[model samples]
Target: HEALADIEDELAGLEAQAMAEQQRMALKQALSELPERTQEIFRLNRIEGMTHAEVARHLEISDSSVQKHLSKALAYV
Candidate 1:
C-alpha cells in the first residue's frame, strides 16, 4: 500500500509537469504567430507576470502602449 501511494504521487507530479509543458508550448506557438514587438510584450506581461507599467518601463514605452500591445496580442492569440 505504501509503494502504491508513492507511485500515485509520482504519477501526479508527472501529469502536472506535462500539463505545464503543454501550456508553455501553446503560449510559444501563439507568440510565434505574432509580430516581434507584440510577442515580446506578451511574453513580458503574460509569461513573466510583469505588470503593464513594469513592461512599459522595461520596453521603454508608455503604459498605454503596453496595454495596446497586450490587447493586440490577445486578439491574435
Candidate 2:
C-alpha cells in the first residue's frame, strides 16, 4: 500500500509538471505574437525579473507606458 501511494504521488507530480509546461509553451506562443516593443517590455519585466520602473528606465519610457505594455502583453497571453 505504501509503495502504491508513493507511485501515485509521483505520477501526480509528473502530471502537474506537464500541465505547467503546456502553460509555459502557450504563454511563449502568445508572446511571440505580440508587437516587437510590447514583447520586449513584457519579457524584460516578466522573464528578467525587472520591475515596471526598471523596465521603463531601461527603455527610457514612462512607468505608465510600461504598465500599458505589460497589460497589453498579458491580454495577448
Candidate 3:
C-alpha cells in the first residue's frame, strides 16, 4: 500500500507537469500569432531576459515604444 501511494503521488505530479507544459505551449502559440515587431520585442523582453530599456536600446526604439509593443503583444496573447 505504501508503494502504491508513492506511485499515485508520482502520477499526480506527472499530470501536473503535463498540464503546465500544455499551458506553456498554448502561450507560445499565442505569442507566435503576434505582429513581427511585437513578437521581437516580446521575445527580447520576456524570453531573452532583456529589460525594456535594453530592448529599446538594441532595437533602436524608445522605451515607451518598447513598452507599447510589449503591452500590445501581451494583449494579443
Candidate 4:
C-alpha cells in the first residue's frame, strides 16, 4: 500500500506537469495573437509583476493606456 501510494503521487506530479505545459503553450499562442505593444504590457504586468502605473512609466505612456492595453490583453487571453 505504501508503494502504491508513492506511485500515485508520482503520477499526479507528472499529470500536473503536463497540465502546466499545456497551459503554457496555450498562453504562448494567445500572446502571439496580441499586438507587440499589448504583449509587452501584458508581460510586464502579468509576468514581471509590474503595476499599471509602473508599466506606463517604463513605456513612457499614460496610466490609462496601460490599463487599456492590459484590458485588451486580458480579454484576448
Q: Pick the candidate with the highest TM-score.
A: 4
Put down candidate 1 lDDT per residue, 1-77, tens digits, no spaces. Answer: 99999999999999999999998889789889888999899989998999999999998999999999999999877
Per-residue lDDT over 1-77 for candidate 3, one digit per residue giving the tens place of the 0 to 100 score: 99999999999999999999999999899988888899999999999999999999999999999999999988887
Candidate 3 minimal-lDDT segment of 10 residues = 27-36
TM-score of 1: 0.76
Model 1 residue-pair collision total = 0
lDDT of 2 by residue, 1-77 (tens): 99999999999999999999999999989899999999999889999999999999999999999999999998778
* Candidate 1: residue 29 Cα off by (Å): 0.4
What is candidate 4's lDDT per residue for 1-77, written digit by digit as tens?
Answer: 99999999999999999999999999999999999999999999999999988999999999999999989988888
Worst 10 residues of 1 by lDDT: 24-33
The per-model lDDT (C-alpha) reads 0.92, 0.94, 0.94, 0.95
Off by over 4 Å in 4: none
- The residue-level lDDT of candidate 3 at 63 comes to 100
Q: Is candidate 1 or candidate 2 better by TM-score?
A: 2
List the pairs of residues colliding in candidate 3: none
Consecutive 10-residue window with the lowest summed lDDT within model 2:
68-77
After TM-score superposition, the amount by which residue 11's alpha carbon in candidate 1 deviates from its true location, in angstroms, is 0.5
Error of 4 at 74 (Å): 0.7
Candidates' TM-scores? 0.76, 0.92, 0.90, 0.96
Cα RMSDs of all predictions?
2.1, 1.0, 1.1, 0.6
